[model samples]
Target chain A: MPALANLTSREELLAEALGEGWRPGPPPGGEAEDAPPDLLPKALPLSQVIRVDYVVPGCPPPAPLIGEFFNAFLSGEMPEPGYVFAKVKALCEECPRTREERVLKKIVRPHELLPAPEVCLLDQGMICLGPVTCGGCSAACPSAGMPCTGCLGPTPKAGDMGLAMISALASLVRAGEEGEETIPKEDEILDALVDPIGTLYKFGVPTSLSPLRERAGVRGSSSPYPVPYQRGRGGEEGGGR
Target chain B: MKKIVIDPITRLEGHGKILLYLDEAGGLKDAVLEIPELRGFERFCQGRRAEEMPQITERICGVCPEAHHLASAKALDECYSAEVPEPARLQRELFYDAYIFSDHLLHLVFLGGPDLLLPQDTPKGQRNVLGVLQAHPELGKQVVKVRARAQRILDLIGGKAIHPVFALPGGVAQPLSQEAREEIRGHAQAMVGLAERMVTFFHEQVLPDPGIQSLLLAEECRLPTHYMGLVDEEGAPNFYHGALRIVSAAGEEIYCGDAREALSLIEEHTEPWTYVKFPYLKEFSWQGFSAGVESGIYRVGPLARINVAERMATPLAQEEFERFFDHFGERPVHATFAYHWARLIEMVQAAEDVARLSEEDALTGREVRGELSSPGEGIGVIEAARGTLFHHYKLSPEGLVEFVNLIVATTHNAAGIGLSVKQMAARVVKEGELDERLLNRVEMAFRAYDPCLACATHFLPGETPLAVEIYDAQGVLKQRIVR
Candidate 1:
């Protein structure tokens, strides 16, 4: 049971038969490593090695948080240099917006709400991502205290991800048969993204009614929601609608 | 005499069923598993909110969605008492080692090497993954280049690789880019030379094939029972998050703690024929059985995590774990074919601790996270790839998450793997022989416990034909059904 040319490399066989600790580059940066450049984006690649077009988020992001964001760009700490999708387009300048309400309705479900710290969840009336998203979630859904499930997917001024999820579900419905300054309709953005089709397709992204069914060029069933049941049986229950 | 059924077995991810029976002195009696299907994701995450359950329970497993986003953000950072910062607990153990390196490279290249490199009566259009890329095309291009370098470390910390959303509680809401740590340090040196050629193609082309080592050295197996996982405070093998121990068959350490007292010794009943529920071990819920060896709930996964680890801090996986403490003695190795030698010594201690954290220059970082706060109940256990997966959650003094239980390691070996598949289908089939391919090779050795079933929900529904009765050595009675 040996020969596949006797095998070895789990790092040269645990670095020469397992003393195995390791550290050729990157560590030091965490306690907000001297704050200042807070708004994010230094794009290190461990000491300027390259390929910085970044976006990778969704939770499993750890390996010591990419080795402290590449040891804060190998210590120069350059965050402001832009294009990490423009620091998630300056999360709509710490968002708060209601600027005399842009077409209202009555919508909630951002995990139901209560905490609202720096405000904005679609301008306090809820449905938020602080004005069309991106700000490295530090504004953590109005500041932890919960709501921006954007999961940091889209934010270089939201050009797409289904037009900022149809402008955050036409700013969470209620505008009525599309009027009070428009938006809402298309069956109220399919009832604000069908109650969460597993958090609107977890992180696969795509949405905005999948390019309006590929700009009306229909292909059929791309799951604009529905079909919740069926998953690891034994304790069955349902409801996505 | 012959009756066997596979039901919903193909390409393993979820869904279940296995049954087999026989008698009249020809031999082999009964065995049933059934798990019919009902992912009540803990009653659809009861009443929701617990930090929106780590992005709604990372859509519970498209095969270990980062173990339901690290047991739902460590049960909403323990139901919101949220401390979470030592750089968000070392970036949640480096994205729980890229969710245990793309779920043990998608179960050794697409669910247990397509029936050990395509054959066991092959034809199902050459048995899948394009018949493992036309039989080992360089192990299917090194299993899609070690799952695209474990999907660039799950797309640099949960943006996506299947279902990630940067597990948040007091940290990780997307933060890591030194150009995604030099493309995860050049895909961790090409996944340490494709995990040493997949540990030499799992010990030479799938454990020396004689139909896969006679279902991995079958000595009328199903071992000494009772073992569980997620160790750590020194006990070793801690997949991510810890506590919950339990070990016995003499290795000792009977039950450790935390994981919300995993419903005080896991129970879960119901079996009006099977949507898989059984569970057991509430002190062997009325134990009654005989088979030549003592049995009451034989355990599961990584041999219940190296028999509930009390050691192993990595020195070559602690010298290959002191040769399994003197090769199973004081009543232990009751052979459930040593769950493939405890899944190749926990896949060579997860490829030697992911090549010692990919030669750590602290694995490149940009201050991952901090400041975490807390508002109450929390739990997170790990060791996934099927086994020890707790989660718990409770929260609400304003933090949100009201409740969510979860458990799941196939509901703690569903009643000791249905009493060792009814004592190995009553000692290898014969009595009125019903063999749906030897009960789907005894439910692919109880799917080497890769069971998730969206983390246990307790139960319901059943009765889809599958009958099989037998009794006779003058005890007369027979019936075999699948239709």
Candidate 2:
């Protein structure tokens, strides 16, 4: 038999059926000449026209898990149509790091210092989203000596992985300490966050509690975060989180 | 006359469609393969820390994340003006070989094997890995075992089987353990055996079948286009380190040397219907889409790599390379199906290189990093499994990415695939006598190229199913095939 054909968008399908002179409408509010086409709208629209079967969650699901899914499918043991996921609820459950509660005096970038192999990266002042992201990858990123950016998306209990991480970072910052005049201010703490949208919603923004448009409060805006970072500036105070 | 749209070409990475326009007399008028998915990746990369590119860019495509990761890392090295330590370079090459071996093996056995093993008219449901397993149970078991072993090697070197984070700006993030090195040596040996088995299988099973052999040599599968790839100092195929080489259709050397100069020799042409841009030779002056020798179109990947290289680096692969040339009758094999043959040869070279790298003591050394400096503009190029991949970035002095551009392997073959599809559609769907079998033949032309539209377009997860709709000249639907 021939190989499979392409999976077309709703617009392409409609245009093919409708003949010539049919073009898709400009995206809401005409964001830019080119923007990352939102996949949620394209993928979710199919549910209205056809029966939705199964949903496999992951930014890019692990290969072994995919193999298992295929094996189960080929063997006729696939479960009923719904969400099929790993048993572990959060990435922290699968992480091998030793966790401890301690307030951090400052935020450290991964490139600035080599993290210890055994301790929690977040505790080491590095921004790791394992606490709020889903597991099933066996903590692949952390095991590789890199912090997890939450590619597995938010855990079921978390409304938004980015917000949860922001909250986590805020609580971890040295705050409300008696007579600690050297404690960093709230703005400094927030400034250290760096590319907040990129960190928080790297993979979950499209399907997050606060979608891009809602968060930006502007249709077709490239950045979902309301706070804007000043470009070409050299200081920490130059850009806001 | 009619128009048929094969939307979302299936069994490959990402989303793309094939449009066939026929005249009222049922003669083929025009054919175009369009990529509709766009992630605006360059825009996404802008303003992000240059150091984070390796991690961020790998998420572009699941099939070849290693390629992106390594390419981005190399680009960062240049951006920071840091010379990578020797041991780190060795480790990176070793990790990359494992990736190439596993990726090529997966494509051959899981994706492209069924078309070679099963009959062309086999039912759609059985034209996949499951069917291949049922037909050749022992070989199927070996495929799984070999792929698992390859993945083990990746995990050992990079600390993750998928989307590895081992590469750093000037060096690798960690040193390889002695135990891990030993483990990899064993797996590498096994991979050599697996590669040998694949060669034997291709020669014994695929070549002997008259029908398949004829199809392999079919006119629809031939394209007299230029070939480009990376080659070592001795002009041998080098996946990790090499200079770019381009050879014309008639086996004449066109250009060789610096990748930047080579990149300057090409330009991209955009069509309003597709998001993916068509890259053609700048020397040809953007002549629009056309087929045959004068079209100024070129191809890159396994076949192109083998065509441009003087010989394979490893002994066994060199012998196989000689045999391949002897069979095909010369360099620059125009038959696109020969991509499979070329891919198998590269697999042998990769496995052998892995074994060679595993035996080296440098892999276990601790000096894996180099000092970093202020950021600047840089470019990284590599021979990914699909073809040559380029990642160019410009960073602010503060190390923030100011600009980004990527020309993935799939994009290089985009124009070539379009031409191949046109030729196949004209040959198989003559006079509007369309049928499922003929459509399969058209798809067969596409599969030979192994085009990964997802990587080309830079969007979403892999493996989207494809569907095709046939419309008459009057814009009335006739039939639809969902695979």
Candidate 3:
């Protein structure tokens, strides 16, 4: 992995981001034609932008975890700044599903399949992000028969969640392909994945490794999303109450 | 002309600003509510799977995510043309009842209750749930216990307390185990007893309060509008699913049918200044916000539900229901403050249903899911914690969402809330005499509706209260009143 320290110069970074010879102040045209009013186009993650002190992971930070945080807070025994007050494990570890068949034969949308009880949703070809998501929610969605949407952000070991998931999915598909006689190649199953970005990078796209992802039939931004950062969780649930 | 802006922008989900235009004499001429509309929700859900909607749409509001989840689930059921099994329906209703009990209790004890429980002179910081708790610690403790119990039941059945993920196209995700069923029964029976205690508190402490009485009888608080809610075949309040019923201001049945026809009956009127759209009956059309037979103005909430339904399904609630109408000595109580009182009445019914549905044999049945046919256009309507919530979707043959439209409880009450604020603003915001108490009176007109727009129910400390800025015609911020 490339060190973030290696990419020090903001000018160089911005130049690379906008174009090879790009400068600040919206080009020679004097005004940015961009539609979305992102406070800072080059906005970094919370840790990157400023000094941070502790985090309780999970979309809303589950009740039990919050209780733990409050206890630690009141006692003045807060852990280090980088310490996230949540289970430091993948969601799949906590998921109560039997994972005997760690293989993806084919991809299926949520409506196309009725997930079997006590079986891993990913094993049933549903694109659950449990393997790549943080475990603080205790596999809440998976237990309920819905695939995990990775709302707790990434787990500690799962660096670059989308890519980590891709690697995991490839190996899972390859394992299935090794036994299937009718299957020509792993490409058949891999190609069947629908709405790739929406499914995989649903939560972390704003601060993603590569935010400006371009594809065929993509919009002007290669994504029409104006959800800069705060509203980045388009499925903005689990806050306020 | 002077303009007064009441900006309640503290809540993160959404912010609303009320612009009160005053004439030279300091008399109110017009009022407009400017709230930021969350755009792109429809577009966001467009290419997503129809089955994924229940999870996605629930994020619209933190306060009533369950409402969105169930409405989306039912809509998906319609899209797939699935006949949800009796077991699943029973489970859904049971879950809904618990939700209603919890949510209504939340509004009663925390949101609207404080306004009446505490004195008007109470400090701005203390005039909320904290003050209510300080006043009645035992009641507060009991309320907290019941709320937690209800939420625990929600977590068990819906899979999580806040944004539930159990509902699917044809039915719920999993069958209720016998253990969970018995657990729900135990919790629900306790809640029923607690609901009755709530009424005892209401009659003992709330009804006789002189300030509350004046607010109830206030001229500005009255609006004779059409009432809408869901009713069972027996014409009783059924929160989960039922035929749509609309009763006129004069206590006559205006329309009774399913959601599709109800959708056709109401038309949305939009304005240039605010994203808040006014939904009114199409029969009378948009007749300029007045409450009469000629205007399309209609309301949906506790007051509307009770007015539209013939009686409460449960006996205890039915008895309270009779006493409620008797106290008013009227059919459709036009007093807007009655919403708070009516909310308590509904809480009784919700608790009763929670206890009753848990005893149903179907609730514990193994067959929680039914078969689905093909994907198509569908509309689902349910009475949310606040009011009638609608979720309409058109799915592609492959089950991807082709179209999406959602009318949450707040949207349905937009026009009524606007008019209520306007009327109150006219009475309260006098020329050269504006105070925080007077502005709060205007806000009282709003909070009574309990329209949890932008998840406005929970207010964290340090967040600004309803701020009023009186501006001259030239748009200079002249006098500011903030709490």
Candidate 4:
């Protein structure tokens, strides 16, 4: 927040060009003094808490779209309330990779291997969220040789992004662990899958109907300090990250 | 007695604050630094997979995600006991070079630079990056553009410039194409040129000013303590990969070891007033907030790296390194303000080395990632732009993360930062009065460390957003200065 060369969300080009974005961090550890003791709060997107008038596409809506919003505001041509300022189609519409309509035999975690650049991440066995996510980021992550983690939020299909992703993944992956190349029985892929909830609901959980119930039970740690997200939360000393 | 509060806070208490207690004669009797917020991260990171850590943990701070990403990847490597391929190491290091280059340039030109670049008496509002840019548009614009170009390199490789995702256990995810390497070299060459010009700017424009001279000679914030940094095999300071090295006030070696062994060498002590824990060398034990070779107090970041290492890893930086030592005429430079100069030297090193790393023949190889085994407990350490960053994890048999601990750069420098604040406050406060000078000196004192204050400033509307409230012995408000 220093004054020197301080660039806001508007000024940073990567954010504008690619819709570069992030998820909400955990709630602050300290709370308001006058808050009710029974206030059991779980992290939820603001749209869920209130009647959202209109949705801006990206986590931080990109510049052109922001410009569109303002132009609409100035010209009094604003879209109907409750509308999303993004494409109705899925993020796959913007993806540049090739999709061969192939079934996946194994699940490849992000770290397992170098993803093939020209092939679709989903087609290459990575659980890319492109099919379920809203388009607008121009497939930035996919183009950079990584899978989409859905920072642009859900499409306007009025369905949970994670659940939709789970259904899509179930259809593609076969029943077997990694390194197995055999054709497997139908709908048996669920047995081979692990951490479905984590992989699926990473960003969408805040807005998902099937939000994590385990978060409540997992709220406090045995250590009492509950130093969760140590890397993200525990940073900012010398350079003030 | 009088109490002067720098950044008096109530609701937004997480930002850095200073409490100066003054005697009747106006000399400070005692001083303290307070930061009032921290939360639990270990609780949430436990149930996740280790492979996702580089991506997840990088979200902790927008400024230094690349540091966390690389460090987490290294910890994952240790957890799985994978020997990384030479090509992957080159790729990660090359990526890290751009990160350090960009980050250091940010601090020197934008955050800390504004203070030194402008005159001491410059109005608070005009002393920021905007003020500096308006005054020297060419220098300011060029630095900003170059900084972005460096991020462009990160974007090309890390997949996300701010939140890099290239790193994974044993290696990186993205393989550099021949085209990408060539592009990186072009940008890095431009960056190297800019860094050298800035170094010249530091000499001609900054060093001659009496304001800077005072800051350089100021005894108030001089802290004589242990220094910690990462040193390469040749004992050259390296930001990406090296063993942790700790040296004493008189330049004596104390401890040199890998990240896991570092866990044993250091101990954490917590205060009842704050959640922030003070870490000290376990060998000497915790001996209060005072600093010295005998006490466990240790400092990190640019000054520490320069002090702890034998030489800089690159040529131009090594030249500046020799000049830095000659300027001090001492084994270790303890002057707090010297950190600014040291940081510029580091920037020169980062920019110069980025070009070298870009041209490495192994940079574009196909074996960018290697296979790994089952996860276990492991530790990883790297020098973040701020200072040394530590990440440790323990995994279950199912490969789910079980335990997590991190000693971030801020945590590493907490004790020293607090001590410096107190020292600067005591030196500047005269006769129980709150004035402009106290704000300037105190600001520079902590800004030396480039601390990430958790406090929100936008809520307050003023030229200087912070309000320093002075109170008497009876806890009555004596005077309030908003600057």
Candidate 5:
């Protein structure tokens, strides 16, 4: 597991937050061997021969949380399930990022990382998977956080690849790029949001506008992209550049 | 000869077709096995952020999500030049073990059991596991209990019984608790006992009987063929990770080295006749099939892994491993029928290893992983139930993925399987009765690869071939298409 910590689990969060009251308690301490905190926490079984144990996190939660949860539970006081364990929480309620529309004529880069609380990026005329993304990490990116990059996979209601929601978000961004307060025309929005490569063309105005190619629309292939793109500034070759 | 056709063999994952062409003179002309489905899984991954692949690729196959997750993670690791730290490595090992354990359990008691215990010609109503229960109630109960236990483990680790999403690019997304660890330990022991009983069943009551064995043995399902698999640090069949090797039918090392080199040496070619692509050494394209240790095309999977590995890591498996080799000698067994024996031995080894790993102190720990500070690539390979699976990828500096190529277990044996089918067809089919039972037997030989047609053919199911035509010099069709 990576050094990243997960505050996703109810037991792990309860032990770490054990009365810490809102200060985001020390990144939910536990062993490092647990799960990396970046995505949904899930337990990794000891082996096929043994029956698996369900940890509060996804497959396996952060190691520290696992240890802490173990200690806390072993200590006799059962760690209460966190918000997600409540059985009635919607994904939006769990996410820190809100959604609303605010038209913008230009693109925002990583340098302009400043975030406004309460107002959503889509509403502000920006592209984001935050609202539509699952918030097991308490909207980790937007909350403490960098922008939400959807580590929790997709939100439960979002459907596979969350095509419709992504399309809506991209169209909203395109409308803002066109300097129009509202998307008065569907064809113009579609044209504005297409990717240069037909590959992910289905994913982008319908997806978003990378600053490098504003005219590039999202292609709708099963593939993530036509050409692999490295993420951020790392030299690593990524499917999405 | 009577015509027999088992149109679609039940209990295997994915879709495939088999055809047997016989000449008017009662000689078999060709036996073709075709896979006809494409999911566009890897192709759809292009342009998407690399980080999304772990989950995205999980959708590739519901039957073996762990295989893709492990392979995808390795591919991403390669993209970044990143090596997973020690703790992360241990954690990943444990994580993968959970998946393998669950999957094997699924295959054996669930998918493969019915065929082993029930009569092949038994009425459809009594051919399934449920039917077995009515005949052998105690064994059925044991199988159900084992399945339930395995499912429990899967639910805890992957959040579901089918597709598990526990693995991530750098490491795992979750960890284990002490209570969970102890439960797993208990289960592991019980499973070992069950496996012992199964071995007895195979030896005492199964293998020596009438039915599939006589025809299988007479038909010579044990011929020598080439084999390939991964070699661990200890030079054994390390199922989780290792190096690649290609061994001749006589058990001599042919090609041994890193996976990337293997990739460069092997070429993939598409044939419009089948959905699966053909893979072979660029140098050995025309060797064709032969009766003996011909440098002809061959196969992979369990028998191959057992042959290439110096020895077994577990005690019981090592004992059984010796007996396995003693029967076959140095030559590679080309007979597709031997795959079951090899699979059983590997299963025994995997079970024993699970028992040992379960008791290790490292199995229960708090510091399961370390911090990732570097941006690099990480490659992971494993000897999946089918064959050698390779996962290579490049991750961006910020921890997102860039490029990926998951050469699955089935893909490695694609060309070889096609060749095996053709060879078996040529030897069988004496009278042009178009024997369905013989055809099914030949098909099973290829299915031993458990080829994932989607992964092998770049995720596209080949369209149903209308016919394969061969013409004489006079322009008359030499062979007409027949059902």
Candidate 6:
């Protein structure tokens, strides 16, 4: 079996299904005028493949976890079927640092400031996805003084990791004494996020609910943001979740 | 004419297939290793921040993520024209050495070792890591322990054993802590001991075995091609930093200079059947891939590195290197199986390098990062565990990546691998009697190169179920084997 057998995108699954004579048509309403035709019959994750016995999560699963999995198999003590994931559901639960809800005056990139060793990176005004990302890596990035970028995909219950991260960030950004008026503008928040899709969906875009477009609805229609994420534009349109 | 397809070649990285064309008499005519996967990585890279390259590119291959990470990071350094600080350079070298030790150990013990250790006629079910473990538990323990120690060293410096987040544009993202340094030193010491044991085991157990020794020097496995690797100013084997060195088939140093010149000296040839483009020296003017000293094809990796280098950097590995030359009786050893021996010697050198670098005071210094400037075009070259890897990038002034051209180690050896498969298939298959053992022998020829097609072909996630089909002269399916 191939190493990445259970980690394919929805489109890849549809292509394979189509090769096996699973014909697919466009979505309802003849599809959006600007959107590509919906070749995917359904948003079926690769994990749902009948032949898939187990899944070892992580952008690249750590060596020790793999060693343990093999050792278990060799010892004839098989893990339960389905997702053989890390014990820690979310990166925040595995992080060694402290976390407390607080307002931020401004967001900062990782290189801008040297973070305190034992403070929550998100609390330090850095855009870290520890709270929304699936853990079991022992908070490797945060422990090394870098912020977690959700490479391990999403928590088990989170429908979309990127959307969860956006909601988390929105709630964390506190308004000044002037109340909601002092809060950072949506554009300002998007600018601070910089490549929000790339950051939040770094490794899980294919598995995320909003693999192509965000749930906020079609862009340039009624949304304040007129354009979608375009490659090589350096986020000039400020389009993100 | 007849065609036999070995689809989804296994026991190696990524997806690939081998096509063997034969005459009506079942005599082999030609063999081609086809890499049918392409993920459009160059397109994906466009519009990404130059700084995110190190992180994004590393995801290309799970087996050699560190190589991609460091190569991408070095490219960023050159793009900004940033001078890496002393401590940062030392840290990068240390991290790279650890990766070399761990990756080489994996190939030697698990991937390639089983073929050399077990009998050639070993049952198909017993020709894998599990079989080796069942046969020799003590050796299995050593393999696990050494790999774990190497992983610890990588985690200590790189932040994670896989997809590490330490490298930055000018330097490493984090400085080494005193405690981490001490831990790494301890692991490095243990690693050196393990490497020495592995070398001794190879000499005593494998070298003396008449069957294995004969197979190592088998004429069917030999391909007299040129060699390419990175060597220091003194012509010593240097994995982290060095100039590109190319040696002709006759062991003459034909080209030695910076990476840019080397890049210009080579051109790529694309075949419609495969996504991988065959790269050959331009001086020969695209004669196409063939067997012989004048094939214009060059191999990279352990055997090529040792063949091209003047000497190993460390004393122990250098001593072993002399013994290797005595056995081969030549400067450029063309025997394909010599790759395993060269890989073992390199593992020893990497272990020694880590021990030496860990004691430096600068390794623990706080000055890890340097300033970055506006982006431009740059090329970064480094000797990955497999061979010399190149990452070329063009970035906009605002630091967004405009273009990317990556020549991974496996891509350099694709032509050589195709030749090897052809040679082995001709020798093993007769009268169209393609059994499990005969088919495995063909796979062994490709596996010896340790080609990571995932990195070479830019493949994406999917199932790779191998299917072998033999077609008769009239294009009628005669036999099919599906796994």
Q: B272-314 in candidate 4: lDDT tens per residue?
A: 3343567889989889989887889898888999999899889
Q: Write down the RMSD of all candidates, one decimal each.
A: 25.1, 8.5, 8.5, 10.1, 17.2, 8.9
For the second chain, the TM-scores of the candidates in order are 0.36, 0.97, 0.95, 0.94, 0.84, 0.97
* Residue-wise C-alpha lDDT for candidate 6, range A203-230, written one tens digit per residue: 6544555324333122222211122212
The alpha-carbon deviation from the true structure for residue B317 of candidate 3, after best TM-score superposition, in angstroms, is 1.1
> How close to the true structure is residue A222 of candidate 4, measured as C-alpha lDDT?
23
Per-candidate TM equals 0.32, 0.85, 0.87, 0.84, 0.65, 0.85
**How would you class the docking of model 2?**
incorrect
Candidate 2 residues B231-279, lDDT tens each? 9999999998788999989888889998755878888766556666678
The fnat score for candidate 1 comes to 0.01
Q: Rank the candidate models, highest lDDT first.
A: 6, 2, 3, 4, 1, 5
| Better model by TM-score: candidate 1 vs candidate 2 | 2
Give per-residue CA lDDT, model 1, range B202-313, as digits (tens): 6566656676655544565545666777777887877876777766665566678775675577665553344344555676563533222244354656767777775665
In order, candidate lDDTs are 0.53, 0.74, 0.74, 0.71, 0.51, 0.76
Candidate 3, residue A240: lDDT:
16
lDDT tens digits, residue span A2-74, model 2: 0000122344333332234444332222214212233333322222345445444454577656766687789
User: Per-residue lDDT for B274-382 in model 3, tens only?
Assistant: 4445788888978876886667889898999999999999898998899889988888889999998889889999999898889888888878777888899999999
- For model 5, the superposed segments whose C-alpha errors exceed 4 Å read A1-241, B1-9, B123-125, B159-161, B286-296, B327-331, B364-379, B394-403, B423-428, B431-439, B458-483
Candidate 6: residue B302 Cα off by (Å): 0.7
What DockQ does each candidate score versus the true complex, computed on alpha carbons? 0.01, 0.15, 0.17, 0.13, 0.03, 0.13
| lDDT accuracy of residue B78 in candidate 3 | 88
